[model samples]
Target: MNTLLEQLKNKRLVWQANQQNAIANTDSTGYQELDVALHGGFPQQGVIDIDSAVGIGEIRLLLPALRARQQQTQRQLVFIAAPMQINGEMFAQAGLSLEHILIIQPETPEHALWSAEQCLKSGCCHSVLLWHQQLEVAQAKRLQLAAEQGDALHLLFRHKRQLSMSLPVNLAMKLSPHAQGLSVQITKRKGGWPDNPFQVDMTKAWPTLTRVRHADNVIQLPQSKVS
Candidate 1:
């Protein structure tokens, strides 16, 4: 089977446990503080998870990067969602033309993950976004590693309560949808903590992600230990 979880013959999967932790992605979420905390956004080869109690700011956080990708590549966004019934016009209004986004519907998480793995590894598309409620740790790990292998950025959206410690996600943040704006919780970081957690208010007019301070890129990381 051409599984997304393809095992490298030279490098055994078990060896991954011993390999040092690596950051997955770091593109701008458009939120400077959040991106700083995330050491960019998500790891370069990342399996970023958006665990949302409510998905208000989550959509806004994603829009900037998605739009940037579309703008840079002039290609469609490969979006796979069973429950993500986002209006195409809403995205288009936010700067992404509806025609520039490709929407695919898969039957289940396995199929969705498999499809995302294939698409990402294929090197034909720009990025992939998926929402799956019942994703397992093993499957997530496979996706994480697969995404890294594919050199693709993947956003895994799960319910807030589902964010746990077992998964090796590059970054895991919790989202709270609110009446006025969205509340984000940068719940987990790998090597060290970001300067601070983020609390971004969703902007309405267009694709804008304002930050705590000026939207600067550099973030002072934790002091490395030298022994």
Candidate 2:
């Protein structure tokens, strides 16, 4: 009994310590449908990866969180796009404030990577988004540690194949745009079913969610809202 009590107390202390130094602070993914897809919302100080090919639903997936960061009461929102091009009009379309976002177009991928690392280290922005097709384990580990040090969320966008392999990620997943629908599959998670997969239709996202037969599906919309 004493051992069990001591173990529990130690666990609490560890949790408290994690909270104290935790960088895992976030509001919500801007998109309601996507937030439900992510099991709640993205972690504040944890590292999250979004893998998608060009001209897919990746932009849609990030809109929610970007919007949320722009709405944060704490700090400004920053996005560093080295490989991809982010336009002011596109940001406005996603409900992200142009003035609140500091867009850094690095001359090279290396420079952009450095910018991202520095941004994470500074712990200034409410959130940081990095566009890189390849992320080495070392780089990810560094960002992960940085996120843990301060309360910040790092969103790394890579390719679809990136999640197919083992990597340094708290949650590894792939998102693709279907026929007016969005499909998501979990590659890895800290403590979740690796085989669990889910999808949400774009049309069913905003006002209502229309349930469909996607083998075993996990619907997260309101009962009345679900069709």
Candidate 3:
């Protein structure tokens, strides 16, 4: 009986590996440097955890891909309990359609997690973004599995301090504001070596500098502010 169970487990592992290989697709992240680092772009289905200090250009870095997805599929992009209010006009200026974006403000972190998982599993949205600083490993795994099953893009934004704590994800990166633009450091990735931190000039996507203000070494701007 034990032997049979072991054989079944092995078969399941093999099936999962085959599925992963079959579904893997290379999508460009719109940033040449990041594309080379990630071997294309973000994974089509999995949890992508981004850790960054507040006011960094984390969301700005993803605008291009999000905009492309919005235009390509015409699917709604869902935001669950975002830490800051999204500026629709800013996203619009960046080429993302405000009509295609849906923002959800959950009352609690647990509610946000539950909503995110449900949104991913429902397959109603092309991508789901969740901002929660405190996420348990199990919760992260749940979100990852939900993303995989739904075949949707899932981006989790967390505080930089969470970098010390591990989370189950396909890709993990540390984002910071640099003089040139947004500095992206691949902290974790599957099936490839992480490269050195690279700069992505967000101004290319967003030429309007009305939002972000960098002065005296202090970043003062609204959420999703682009440099």
Candidate 4:
């Protein structure tokens, strides 16, 4: 019995080692600081959860890497049940080809999850991004399995409130707006430490200028030019 127990322990160790090795193989996220924090970037193929406040530019944070992946693979980038309409011109200005993007609007969250899982399992897209307001652990698990089966990058955008809920994803990050740009905190990662929050200047990666009104009845320049 003792010998059998030792054998089982050894097998577990081997499995863990293999998992770590697999996670080590990742693609760059296009931001040097983020890449370092993630120990490379998003896992080559798996579910990544991004939790952020509304209108915080969560999509913008990932635009650089997503654009790079699309260009490299020349495959479709699918969006499932996005809460808001994606502006093709904005993405185009940020270096992503609108032709490569496919947006799907599902009436319900269940349908959105189903569509996203199908897209991942079909291996038809290079990457799948889904915007979901709420997600159960079971649904997240299914998505993770589908991602593994298809070997496609799956990214889920959810509200920051869902950060407390546990999900079986390869990586989970929280994005908050910062003075410089976006503040990213890795809440969970497989085979990687949850280090301190790091700042990624996504503003430079995808520049957008907007006017602002000052208190003294003066029009302020764009935030990018303020400092």
Candidate 5:
């Protein structure tokens, strides 16, 4: 029995229950508050489901982490079916390499899924962002498997709605716009508990994007000087 146990351990097939509870490999999320909440940062490579409306700092929150992943792996970052044109200046400000980024717009949702799966399975991309509204369980699972196979991160962006069902993803969260940055609620996480809504302050990184509140309960934007 001792020899068998040693062999299993050598094969990396055995682990303590506590090890399962311990935090897995993660990269810094760039935001300190988010990193603490995530017990490190985002998962190194897996599916991250973000349920939020478009153009509300959702992509901003992820840019830093994506850039980190790309830098660490020296792989391309692919965006599929993005709702709007890719903003080069914004991503550049976040330190992502423009030359390493690729954009694909599929004609149909089916094609989008195929493109995303191929990109994730190609092993040349560090992260793939797919802006999709709907997905069945099997499709989500396929994407998850592809990400694992190629050692990449898959980010699924969708509309914020009450989740009647769950997808097989490593992390799932809902985001709402907040004055400071974003109000985030973790619906599910692989090796952690669901978190109550927490504020991810973006004021320091993006003062213009956040709302400023006065002592009298009035909110306003920081005015930009006219060019």
Candidate 6:
């Protein structure tokens, strides 16, 4: 029994909570405040859950980190089942190579997950973004394993309202729109504690996207006369 226990510990199949308090590797998130909250930054390679409403600066918030990963690895960044048409201009503005991006609109949700897994395990992708609304714990575990196998990042984007239970992911965060940028709350992180809600400033990087301090000025044009 003693020898069996030792083997398990050596393989990291078992560990005390206090013993696993820090992640082994991380990449800078580009946002100083967000990076500080996330210890150093996002994990280098693993599954991450981002729960946020679409078109709420969620993609913008991740652009910097994803861009960094793509450049560092010089690998493809694949998108599986994107909700809307991807704008290359936005990616170009963020300094991502347009040629390095591959967008796949899967025919079904199951296919979406399959595509994401393939990209993560291909060893040629730096990151795979999957806009999937439903995911089971088992499925998430499989993706996590695939990410580890290929040393890639798997980003799962879904609405917070759809989440029913905690997922077995490396990191999970909730995002909402804020005047300055995006308000982020760290809900779950492996080897780390949950952090309070904090604002990730986007004004400096994206002045036009951040909310402006101005009163509502309604310009009501005269109603056109109808025949």
Best by lDDT: 6
Tens-digit per-residue lDDT, 120-165, candidate 6: 9989999999998888888998999999999999999989545558
Q: In TM-score terms, which candidate is top? A: 6
Candidate 5 regions with alpha-carbon error over 4 angstroms: 1-23, 213-227
* Root-mean-square deviation of candidate 2: 9.7
lDDT assessment of candidate 3: 0.79
Off by over 4 Å in 3: 1-23, 207-227
Q: Give candidate 4's total backbone clashes.
A: 0
lDDT per residue (tens digit) for residues 88-190 in model 1:
7778777887776778898776788898877677665667788877777788778877777777777877784443444667667777664435666776556
Each model's lDDT comes to 0.66, 0.66, 0.79, 0.79, 0.87, 0.88
| CA error at residue 109 for candidate 1, angstroms | 2.8
Q: TM-score of model 2 relative to the true fold? A: 0.70
User: What global local distance difference test value does model 5 have?
Assistant: 0.87
Better model by lDDT: candidate 2 vs candidate 4: 4
Q: Is candidate 3 or candidate 6 better by lDDT?
A: 6
lDDT string for model 2 (83-132, tens) is 66766886787677777778888888888888877777676776787888
Q: Which runs of model 1 end up more than 4 angstroms from their true locations?
A: 1-25, 163-165, 194-197, 204-227
RMSD of each: 11.7, 9.7, 9.3, 7.3, 8.1, 7.0
Model 6 error, position 224 (Å) = 39
Please give me the total number of clashing residue pairs in predicted model 2: 8
User: Residue 22 of model 6: what lDDT?
Assistant: 63
Pull out the clashing pairs in model 3.
none
Clashing pairs in 5: none
Candidate 2 accuracy as lDDT = 0.66
* lDDT value, candidate 4, whole model: 0.79
Which ranges in model 4 have alpha carbons more than 4 Å from their true place?
Answer: 1-22, 162-164, 206-227
Alpha carbon lDDT at 169, candidate 5: 87
Model 5 earns a TM-score of: 0.84
For residues 1-227, write the lDDT of model 5, one tens digit per residue.
Answer: 99999996784345444444634788999999888888898887779999999888999999888877877767899999999889999888888889999999999999999999999999999999999988987898899999999999999998954488678788898999999999999888765667899999998889999887558866799999999
What root-mean-square deviation over C-alphas does model 5 reach?
8.1
Which window of ten consecutive residues has the lowest lDDT sum in model 3?
14-23
lDDT of 5 at 93: 82
